[model samples]
Target: MKQQSLALHETMEVHEMLNLKTVSMTTSKMMEGVVFDQDLKALLEKDVQQSIGAINDLQRLLKKAPKIE
Candidate 1:
């Protein structure tokens, strides 16, 4: 499949989003071990899963983005 190119600003934006998602997922996963409430733990797990999907999508877009020197 042909990869689509992203403009510099778009690439930066995606990179920022990827970083944010990574941090969010990491935080949720860590909190899962500490939270006592089952409901909140479940919510955290859901957020982690959604973040994984979003991070994967962002990584794919980044692969199409031009590499910075």
Candidate 2:
């Protein structure tokens, strides 16, 4: 079915985005110590927190998503 195919495609795309965001979260945490500026460090920390929440939400959604295979 076209609908199933579309759903699978969207699920894959979301997975890819989730992976990218997870990597970004790790980099942000690591870069917190690497940054010398206080403002940038704060921003990175905030991004890290936001990414964590987003990852959790995405994972929950993924659990409810239809299996592709």
Candidate 3:
């Protein structure tokens, strides 16, 4: 009976440890995805700003040119 109890306790401990490990891995993956998403958003915003600036510069240059028939 004592040996059976020890085996049962060990099995329970191992099961709990596996669950903890799974949770830890899942959390880590979620954090990594969040970080990647944030980086992508920042890069997209920067690209948009650059495009707007280029358009404004082009408009200004166009305004400076003399009109020709």
Mark the regions of model 2 whose C-alpha exceeds 4 Å error after superposition. Answer: 1-6
lDDT per residue as tens, model 2, 1-69: 333323666778779989999999999999998899999999999999999999998887676567657
The superposed Cα distance between candidate 1 and the true structure at residue 20, in angstroms, equals 0.4
Candidate maximizing TM-score: 1
lDDT of each: 0.95, 0.86, 0.51
Which regions of candidate 1 fall more than 4 Å away from where they truly are? 1-3
For model 1, residues 1-69, the per-residue Cα lDDT tens digits are: 876799999999998999999999999999999999999999999999999999999998998898779
TM-score of 2: 0.80
Q: Which TM-score value belongs to model 1?
A: 0.90
| lDDT score for candidate 2 against the true structure | 0.86
Candidate 3 residue 29 Cα shift, in angstroms, is 0.6
Candidate 3 colliding pairs, count: 0
Error of 2 at 54 (Å): 0.8
Residue pairs of candidate 1 with colliding backbone atoms: none
Total backbone clashes of candidate 2, pairs 3 or more residues apart or in separate chains: 0
Mind giving the per-residue lDDT tens digits that candidate 3 earns over 6-44?
Answer: 244454554565455455545554455456577765665
Better of 1 and 3 by lDDT: 1
Ranking by TM-score: 1, 2, 3
